[model samples]
Target: VEPKITLTDKELQAEISELCKYAALLDDSQLEVQVKDGVAVLNGRVASSYQKSYADLLAYRAGAKEVDSRGINVHWRHTNPLLRAQRYEKVTDEDIQAAIQRAFKHDPRLLSFEPQVKVEHGVVTLTGDVGHLTAQQAAEQDALHTIGVQRVKNNLRVRWPDEPASDEQIADYTRAAMTRDPYVERHNLNIECENAHVSLYGVVDTQFEKYHAEWIASRQKGVVHVNDYLAVRTKWKPKSDAAIEADLKDKLAYAFVDPDNQVTAKVENGVAILQGTVDTWYMWQTALDQAIAAGAREPHCLIEVRYGLPSGPHYYGPHDYVPR
Candidate 1:
């Protein structure tokens, strides 16, 4: 027998509130829901392209028997993606670094190798220069599982000194190593060699490249040491302002591929300037990449990520903050 008493308006509102609470927990902004005529209608925005999707995730979790989500807006940034990306590298180098540091401090066998981690906008870039691939991968996996990291960019490559090579072979090996760098390969950063050592006097926009170069130099067979003077140079190369403008426009597509973040770049004499509004740290990194890839020589990107708004002390300062 069906219950005789129908649920009151107040009861429905309370139930809706409870369900929305779960949505808040999921941090899913995919839909805004409404209950009317004993039916739940959902409307909002989602980033996935799948129409027949699991987006009813929160609705189902919250006990919606019949959910209508046709009104929800679908949004996606990349259409013709670079590849069928199984995943995008998202973990920051910092989160992984802290994880490794704490893990080793707690357990003894981890210190035989040097570990490098860089976190920029929640994405971690791992470059283990210990010359042991096994240890490098292990350290990277440790960082991937660390809290607060959304993705990982495995830039960890095997070093030369540990790869069985002579001192003379080391110089040629170092040059070869420098060329293999994605940033170097993509023509993102510039390199110059003096003696057996190489001076990577270039500006890199992302913190990933900043530390990546360091790791490469630290582990190269012949390199005694790399000069840290090669800061994250975001300066662009250009003779005329018009040339700078041209370069900036050309590079915009590389970094600002995501339509949501509106970013523009301009370069003059190797100094790159970026301006635009972005909602997150990931977008900020993209802007930096754009500046460097646009034929900038040691590009110095002075782009704003969050308008430099000061937050509460407890609030993390993104890249500046190292997790406890």
Candidate 2:
């Protein structure tokens, strides 16, 4: 049996305040923290959604039973020069195609498959068959990160070299893969296979684990498509909307390595709404993954990809590096 820990309300409040003061993302000078009956209420404004959410997590870590952050408002700042430059510079169709090819060449997973790329104005259409779903996603990401790409139409299909395995075989492979994956192995997931498609039905703590399960299943040798019906299991001791939102914001900020990416999250009635801009499709997907991890039941992702921009803090030539 686990031992129960207790703290007085005054002690809890002091600890929460100290935690907030030392938090790297939060501006302690602008915010105020109050505690009552182990619940912490945060007031004031933050520069980004990331900071607001991070502050809430600090409160929880400091032994607050609950956190309220509705008083905090998000005031975002526009700092990216590339976003400003887009209004003046016009990227041609040829440049978009070249950029897409460069992105494909840079990604080790997509290096083997030469998907045909076509560009019309700023719209890119990719049509080819890859070994698996991850490669197909990589191809679409290639188009999404290309400069001047206004939209991506990924018609890439999965084409495996080996003979199609039976549903039982696919299920076996999926189970083995899930067992091997560190993120997914801890959960008691239910796996179902039909034809080449696999379905996952289970409850996990975070959105990352839910998507990670799907990613693992999608990579199985015979998997053509994955149907994820996995749910995020709420903890026995539930957190307030403010706490969940704050947790989500920190998760998203950490999940996407690029500091320039501006993503924000809001939670209401267990639903999380995300809005902002990222440099690549991977980061966009990662933002959604973080939302799910934060225990949002229905995460509405409104994030957009601004391709052909630097993905990280440092320069890595002209093309964005493919996340391994």
Candidate 2's residue-wise lDDT over 1-324, tens digit each? 321227687877766665454332442235788878777899976768877887786666556678899988777652334533552155578766765675575466786898999999788899988999889887886567444567889898898897888777777788888888888787655466666777775456678898889889888887888878766755534557898898998887677666788888898877778888887544655666676678776566666556522212222332211111
Clashes (candidate 2)? 4
- Provide TM-scores for the models: 0.27, 0.49
Candidate 1 stretches greater than 4 Å from native: 1-239, 257-259, 297-302, 306-324
Best by TM-score: 2
| lDDT of all predictions | 0.50, 0.69
Best by lDDT: 2
Q: Estimate the TM-score for candidate 2.
A: 0.49
Model 1 C-alpha RMSD to native: 20.8
Instruction: Show model 2 residue runs off by greater than 4 Å.
Output: 1-83, 87-89, 238-324
**Candidate 2 Cα RMSD after full superposition onto the native fold (Å):** 23.0
